[model samples]
Target: MSPARLIGLLAALLVAVAGLGYLASLTLLAPAEIDVSQQQAYVAAPVPAEAAAPVAPAGEPVGVPVVDAGWLATNAEASGVPEPALRAYATAQLRVDKSCSLGWTTLAGIGWVESQHGTIGDRVLQADGHSSSRILGPALDGSGSFAAIPATPESTMWHGNDRWDHAVGPMQFIPTTWDIWGSDGDGDGVSDPNDLDDAAYAAARYLCADGHDLTTGQGWADAIFSYNHAQTYVDAVHSAATAYAERTSR
Candidate 1:
């Protein structure tokens, strides 16, 4: 399907199930700017990535001063971030020209919370930022916990489950969330969920929606909260991000 139709479907679904208020932060880029694939919400993990790891996408600045690959490798355990993934965050931060400059550490923090930088329990991140094992969340079962989003297999050809939809990629975004916020971070035609570079960049865009500057306390808190609605999730991400910033971004 065309990118416009995909976006319209995503926005319309969210408005129908979640409410119009929840649509406030969904980014609305032109069809040309947005990724043009209905399958973009969850790029299948089975497809092998391009052998050469992705660099910064074309036409973006690569002038970020955040921690480099050497630093991440040296302090791997301390930051719990791998070199290539760290580099992706740094490059995305440098390239994204927004009022609320996203730092590499913030991505690291969220990465830590989401999937341990795609190293969850021995699943390692490959050069292309695709995790060895695709991490996913259980059905949003609504049980008064996560906002119940009906299984989207009917709408999404990406995730094939019939009874429930799983959150794809290292970042654990539901199909709806991925549909509305996903983007092609790697310059590849597809906005893959399993690719760390792709996932990290999409996440940066999502958090900074509405020009949210994450450098300040409230802004930091708000952005994290937007990523996940829970206060505990925000606190955990903030703590990790702060630790990373104190040592890296500063």
Candidate 2:
């Protein structure tokens, strides 16, 4: 109740007032209540103009290149092409000769199926003391004119130096046949069975020469058959050719 008590009481009162004012200011500055019935609308942010717009899918009747048979015959050297150049060459060749694209693809597939893309080998021994060998099939026919008579322990044909041989290379061409039919496919001036370009072009030429149209569906089938006489070979070639077309088109 004295002067000191009065001062203390006044200080307490001032503190209480200051606390109340701080709380009041906070409540007054607080966000207003959101409406219940009058709901707030939200809009998605606009996409940036620089953002790429969704691209529409290309419609059917998509442009596909068409290739000619005669052109393939003349450009048989194209098969010797390499890497990125090889792909572009193949694409261009197939585009112009897209009709024969199936034929080429079929040939490639057949080569794969027939000889594991030409990775087979064979050894033949002649009874007359002459020895000859092959890879893939028994050296075609006129390759060496030597008949493979199987091995002795096998009871198939030859006993010592006369026996049939396996095929080799990407196209599965016998060493002898390759010596004859193999050609430069990539324009590198060297015919190699291991070369995909050379192999592909050789196959194209072989099919074209084998009474295949290289331009029509039936021709494609015929060319495939000429490569190998197996039904599986035909089916595999067709499937591969179709797949190649689809991939290249994309």
Candidate 3:
């Protein structure tokens, strides 16, 4: 071949190789985004009334983390929850109710709605399952947008207020509720609501209380409404939980 023709052929080969490399890089760098509505339609179809599954009695505390790291990592990526928070939610299930009807996704929904898994307001959820900073809500002194809640004797210890009670920690539990349902989930023997592990376990126990069955739509709605009376809150939790379940199903 002529020198010019040979040079042109070499240039064409180089261009083709570069094009292939660009395509491969695109494939590796940008994965296909998850189709949430499609996944929910398929994987999270509404349960029939007759198909409601009963929750079993809560098991004794296992006193250990029960979720596999591999599973936690996979779900954390898929559901947009940090691995530490995901582990807390999953382990809370094993610690309290191992019911097939309720999964970690429900607790995760609450965590996300309440405090974004303790990362709300730019705070971080530490590796030890505690928030980098305290996550406290406004005082419930029966003032604007809040109901009146007189401070309990130990309220100041948790929320730094002796005049009025505030919702404390990642789960946003008021002092009275915390007194009844607080738990120690990390095996550290302290039931601190700021700790994700303990807070998650407390939430699970509260939701699963009195043999609540979460498989059916009505039952699940009731459980969430008990957490927060607002219908919008229940709907938001349902939406988040359904999305998480759909994402992790892949």
What are the per-residue Cα lDDT tens digits for candidate 3 across 50-114?
Answer: 32122232554433545555556766897799999987887776656445345677788788888
lDDT of 2: 0.38
Give candidate 1's TM-score: 0.67
Ranking of all predicted structures according to TM-score, beginning with the best and ending with the worst: 3, 1, 2
Candidates sorted on lDDT, descending: 3, 1, 2
- Runs in model 1 lying further than 4 Å from the true structure: 1-78, 154-157
| lDDT (Cα atoms) of all candidates against the true structure | 0.59, 0.38, 0.68
Q: Of the pair 1 and 2, which is ahead by lDDT?
A: 1
Higher-scoring candidate on lDDT, 2 or 3 = 3
Residue 174's lDDT in candidate 1: 70
Question: What lDDT does candidate 2 reach at residue 109?
Answer: 43
lDDT at residue 169 of model 2 (Cα atoms): 46
In model 3, the runs with Cα more than 4 Å from the true position are 1-62
lDDT of 2 by residue, 1-250 (tens): 7664554445333322322332222212222221222111111122222322122233433222223333333333332211222222233234233333332334434544443333323322222111144222433222443333223332122112234433444455444444445555544455555555555555555554544455555665665665555555565555544443333222
C-alpha displacement of 198 in model 2, angstroms? 1.9
Cα lDDT for residue 101, candidate 3:
49
The alpha-carbon lDDT assigned to residue 246 of candidate 2 equals 34
How accurate locally is residue 127 in candidate 3, as Cα lDDT from 0 to 100?
91
